[model samples]
Target: MGSVTTTEQDLRARAEEVLSTLAGEDARLREDQWTAIEALVAQHRRALVVQRTGWGKSAVYFVATALLREQGAGPTVIVSPLLALMRNQIDAAIRAGIVAVTVNSANNDEWDAVYADIENGDVDVLLVSPERLNNPDFRDRVLPKLAASAGMLVVDEAHCVSDWGHDFRPDYRRLRTLIVELPSGIPVLATTATANDRVVTDVSEQLDLGTGEQTLVLRGSLDRESLRLAVVPLPTPARRLAWLASKLDEMPGAGIVYTLTVQAAEDVAEFLTERGFAVRSYSGKTAPDERLDAEADLLGNRVKALVATSALGMGFDKPDLGFVVHLGAPASPVAYYQQIGRAGRALERAEVVLLPGREDRDIWAYFASLAFPPEPLVRQTLGVLSDQPLSTASIETRVDLSRTRLEMLLKVLDADGAAKRVKGGWIATGVDWHYDAERHRRVAEARRTEQQAMLDYIATDECRLVFLRRQLDDPDPTPCGRCDTCTGTVWSDDVSADGEAAADERLSRPGVEVPPRKMWPSGMAELGVDVSGKIAAGELAGVGRAIGRLSDIGWGTRLRELLGSEDRPADDVPVPSDVLDAVVRVLAGWGWERRPVGVIGIGSRTRPHQLEHLARRIAEIGRLPLLGTLPPVGEKPGARENSAQRLAAVWGGLDTAALPDLSGVDGPVLLVDDVLDTGWTMTVAARAVRRAGAPEVLPLTLAVDG
Candidate 1:
């Protein structure tokens, strides 16, 4: 079955035989395939089919339209995006004697006649893109005619409806409204070659589909055995060209060389052609006829290779693509999967090479940031809105942007939920500046985090194919035997010896640990101090570790002596500069600390037993035990009880007389929350204690704050 269908039995039989003849030299079909094709045609309404790329997805709908028309079921309507694809489908239909017409940006007048035919039930299927459904002319005139005739609505690339998808188009969201407004309860047939779990949910929701009985007929294998994977590091332009040349000499079949930009494609194609290779360039700027010519030349082997952008593979299918090369890294794993899928369509052995360098990391990081609206720009855009609705043109003047850039910015603003369009005018819908600043700040941080995650994945030493398979949800995949690491052909030594290491192993370890510096024997002790902007459990634990290690190495007694017996004069609290030096000197000697690069961490070389003991001591550093209750205010007891009472009394008696007039203070107040078992509690406690003492208190808790 083909997209070209016929109303007459003899015509359909002749068309099927004709398609079978064309496919005889390429792909073979089975009886079950026709059964599946017939099942799809038999549906009275629109249906969705989830199948793999090479599964002959086009045939299902084409055959169905022909069968229905032959049985007097009237016409079908298709909305598609690509003009080239439409022509290809229409030509196939014409060959089968099935009546079909197209409406695209290129031929507005022709659509009128097509509409007339569709209204009279003279056509079988109407193919269309989601974008065309939004045109006011088509919506007002064309759609009503087809609706009156009870035609089926077919959406190709249906995954575009999902915002989560890589190819989302805002216009796709409007299809739901169209589907709802169509007559005869117009059923939709949504089809796509690639979709993950999230994409599947989006398809169902966007299409208004029933969950159980009205679901799609999913078919096809995820595996494509003919494809081979390879990675070649080309850190320099010269190295990249040389490697590409070598690949061309090795792989004989026609191929695609994908790059990040038009310039790269042009450069590579020119370079190859100069070397006596049959090569040509294809990019977004290439003319439609020229592009089609290039595609046909590549398919016929008249062109040895095509250096192209990712756009080259979307609609055209060349079954004998022997290789697909990535001249640069794709923006994402998803993009990479799609670009590489273009290869090996004939199910013959093929190769895919990814040439990624250090520059790619920065490139992708920059791309991620681009998706987020910058705070300054957004704030400026909001400031110009004047709290009034305005046409995009008027807003452009107020926003001080050229028409083109302003339109682009407005679209981004809308996507970010920062603005909205209503009543033929734009309105600022982003949050109020005062409250939304914090939210926007968080979003910025999230973008940074995601950018870091992507960088980490690229630099990771895991199997590349496995990572891709996981991301795409491809099933039962073996490590791509052709990738650099698997084939032992990689040039980068960054890949560790371990096939798969534990998470802890990913944590970079020091070459070797050094012993803590010895503390000089003297009256003076140095203390290091660092203040936190926010309190956290992890920080407290780290502080406990540093303190316990210090105490274990014999710095505890000296530390306790510094606090003295009674509350010091307000002015007597040790200055941070004085205390910081003493603490640093002492810790440096205790084998517990080392400030390397910019961060401090526990010395890994510390004796296991000592480290374990230190860990245990710091575990409860911040926790206070239940000290026994005190006697009434005046009644004194034994030394221990008396000491506790004295402590409580000093803190309790702070009221009237010339007390440090600390009221109405707005700054930080350090509290003596608990004791310190390890020095951490005392060190941290000292800072807090001094801060509460007034403008700042030095915390000197008896126990370490773990």
Candidate 2:
């Protein structure tokens, strides 16, 4: 509840006892580590000691334990989010000669033994995972049994509780609640290797500690000046591997090559192994023991390098890493910083190489696409998991997906701690229950867009360091005079195939009139044209179908063409080239006359000027349908739902009517449809429209299912 009653002499004596217990004469705490511990003991306050990786975060915990024990307090309970981390710290504690026992799921006997020892004042330190601590049974059955227990709650990797932190674990959210249930004023010490400003705030809020309450200690940015960061762009797959090989040759250190996929990791590792580079691969599928062995080999220099996915470095503390190579683009800067931070931990020179290009971008985009499951698929999955445990059959029956893809999706959910496998089926965890599918999808989309931006960044021939620094939100990025782009060593921006920078010249030349919304103000000026007659009604219906069809087709170039009509000459009005071309193509395919110009209207007879104008107007109407229709007679733009607007609405809900063969009407016209829930309705409409009077119809929609 408060600072240890142990005096400075008592602490020093206990420190000596801990060293003697560990049987190491020179294994003493560094000045910074000792000062941090003393500050914690003196004030009995919460503190944020941001020691860098390999800076002995674990050792500080032991120092606190010794001080607390010397004051005859109960055994200190250290809460961590990860069981692996708890075990790692316990191992380190044993090595440091601290008597510690872990109460985690992996070993029940050890857990009970530790609880009994703590209750009887037999153990000095008690380590438990946050998940174990949250278990109500543990608090009711095990925790209350501890004797004289008023020890501090030392939280490791506190960033996990912060929403803004990259790896947010929802279980951590209940930590504050759990702490409140514990002894009041139990000094809370939170530690992390990395904590940005937002993360720090999160820790403070969740722990109920104010800034003044938190003994703040910040080590300067651990940016290894010796670690050279380079982004290499390879347009194609073959070139990407070649670039990777070249970079690997340049470093040839005990490094790790991280990739976006397990297959990529395996392939890269195999390739390196074949090329006689000592390489071992690690991924989620790699057995835990095997992964640990591989990591140990890499850190111990037994394996020259490790080819891994992002799964390897959760709490890895390797300082001798000479390089951290990203085989593809990571999702965000936070990810990149964490991976790269693994290198140069010893303040030794290292390198962070990124072989990023179009192929890597494509792979990242593909993964991101998986992040956003279709709404129907998500709804179906949720429904299936409603009554029973979720299995492959349930998902397959509910969501139409291949076995391979479904398995990947399930794994992704599992990795994000959304659902956990139980009794051969997936059950939603607390984290999964709170899963906002749409929000996650939006995040995925945003990441994909950002990945594209990163690709653009890599492809650009600009000051690479400046670009990287700016992305990290660095305020004063004086160009690091070292990168290939900064020096004349390499070019940054690539020139177009034609040599000069891509042209931004006059795209629209004179002569052609850009299609206006109303080509025939006089021809069809009336808001409500007489639709009682078969020909007029049929024409209106056909135009409506064509308008609907346009929504489905890709409009990138068309949008540009519309916007491109800016500085064109008067008569040179760009003839809505894009929309006209679309209409002509549709008509030709539908076997229509596909007239060259004059009014392309559907009527028995019309004046030549009117015909030409109708053709133009049809194209214009395709762009913006309400142009020819008038608003309600008394309505203004602000308060108008005119006949034209109402007609457009009706068109969206129209049933295609049979038309009599009209003499003047000709071939295929572009038809726009919004979304294809099922292709049948549009198919039937196309047929009926063609049979009536229109020669042909090409129907398109915005999106369609396979």
Candidate 3:
């Protein structure tokens, strides 16, 4: 907003009016909130507010928006992350007579209307996601106009702007470009509750308007007096789940049960619901409508809790949220602090329980692997993208990266000026680009340090809040005297017998559906495979079955011991009897359209004995004939490789000639394997079996990657 000719008293009065409207008639502005408002509105200064979650960070912006618009400046532009956050912010804006509209991925149908409202000056605040800022159409058509005329800019969850932050997003790096292009004296306010000293400096640098003016940073303490932290270093996932099942009722109020992955969220929600608890799962995979319902349910206290991943972390506002229970520790203490901040916002007492499990480290490493790829991989990706535009699918054919990682790398390259995103796809800019190897290396090392700090948090015997707050560089962090360590743990270490029994039973249960791959990976022809489009209907593999996922709590725990990766690889021994029994149960429970007449093993270089043993046992138990082994005839890629690479490796890698005459078998054949990663091996192998004259194929696997 342009500098307003206003006195401090006048500005404070106006800000108080807005605050009262948003909160209540008796509501007053905190001194720090008033200071931020004055800096933005009266002096047109850029600012950063790093206060606690409920400390009126939003009030500063809302009040400034009212004053600026009242003084005839353009509407405020807010770059928020979550749809739930936007919804809540819009509602809060409306309370102060501010017309706010959001243009996110979920509301494409209403974008035109929203845009018209903005143009007509009928909207006071425009909320968008950071990704929307770089959309080809939006960036080309709308951003220039908005930057030319916006009053103020707000970056919610500002820590994400720094690559060193726990949730660094590449799209946020574009804020620098957006800021540089803004007109002089246009105020920018970046706010977050989770940033430490390093993130604060990084965000402050990004917030610099380059108008010979400095960013006014106001960082406050990161402690939450209302939160009582507790940590339970459970020995097993089953015990942790069991403890949750037992202690949930004793928890303070309606809250959240946090998980590290989508499958865990769904699994925990299902287990709790089966135990007659009112809970639903929320994750990045949940449908928007379902997320809305779940959010509404929790807001209304219609459910006891929502089992959610980090997707439900930032910007979710529920002042009276009673507690937050993390099933596993996050990779960093800073991130854990942010997630637990959701609780005790408006209450005097709320429980913050952490049930740290051994599997958390594995999950952390999986995410770590997705960090900025090595320079060689980056050079390869750049080599693939020439002057001609290639959609991400086309790029996948040439570069060996997963879809998620590929998208992230493309964004980084796009920001690095080595690639440009266009409507059709991405085009190489031919810039003399150099990968920031040093920076990324430091970031990676920082991640390891943060992960170890998290482990240390679990093992610490000192003040819990002090340990967490100190990670955020809080000034003089001291004991809160409210945590379990300071005030002895409230809950017992032992899980009730009944709760443990139910959880063990649930974890031990078998049979996860393994749907067949219908359409082949795009650009397979370019990869030298002729197969494309849907699998030939006559040759399609039927829906398959797996005893469990590698990430599952029950059979997964056991199966991992046998088929686990480098950490726990098993010797090529005979299949365990219990596992065989689980397979028997899975097969008996699977109501296939046609029962298999024979079983065939897909040979594994790593576990040939185990695969053959399981296949032979299944054939013997089912009273079916043992057909043959589909031996590997070519070099195969790692099981964790992307779909395109995996497919190319296994296209003709199987020796169909190894099989005996299958002409006599007319019914379904059980295509068995030790583990399924990308599912390409199974697809190619099953296609060969069907072509070998088997009428139908029922694929079975010991474990599937979650």
Using TM-score as the measure, the top candidate is 3
- Cα-based lDDT for every prediction: 0.52, 0.54, 0.88
Which ranges in model 2 have alpha carbons more than 4 Å from their true place? 1-35, 81-84, 103-105, 133-140, 143-150, 209-219, 246-249, 359-706
The candidate scoring highest on lDDT is 3
Residue-by-residue lDDT tens digits, candidate 1, 1-706: 6564454345446436645533443444444445444444544444556555566666655665665566566576766667766776786677555777887767777887877777766777676765566554676667666666644567776766765555655666666656666664445577776666667766776565432235454544455667666666644544566556655767748889887666567666876776678999998888888888898899898987888986686566777888888877776565577677777877558877777654454345434534424567557777766446767644543343434445556654554446655555667874554325665476456445444544444565565666666555666456766665566765432322231122112111111111111221111111112222333322222222122111210222223333322232122233233333433333344343322111111211212232222222322232322111111222332211111122222222221222233333433222222223223322333222223233432222222311
Q: For each candidate, what TM-score against the reference?
A: 0.57, 0.55, 0.97
**Tens digit per residue, CA lDDT, model 3, 601-638:** 99988888888889999999999888999999867555
lDDT of 3 at 556: 61
Q: Write the residue-wise lDDT of candidate 2 on 1-706 in tens digits.
A: 4565557657756666665554366666676666667766655666666555666677776877777676666777787765456667777778765678887766876665666667687777787776664355674567555412657778787777764565555556556655555555456678876666656776876666332354445443433455566676645434455455545666746888887777567666766676567889998788878877887798788877788887866567676788888877776665566677788776556767787643454345445444445656654555555334666644554455545556555544554545544554676654633456666665556565556557666666676555654444443456665556666564233433321211111111111111112111111123343222123323332322231111111232233233221232123233355445544444434333453221122211112233244344555644423111101122122211122323222332323332334334544544443233324334334444544555545443322321
CA RMSD for every model? 20.8, 16.0, 2.2
When 1 and 2 are scored with lDDT, the better candidate is 2
Model 3 clashes, total count: 2
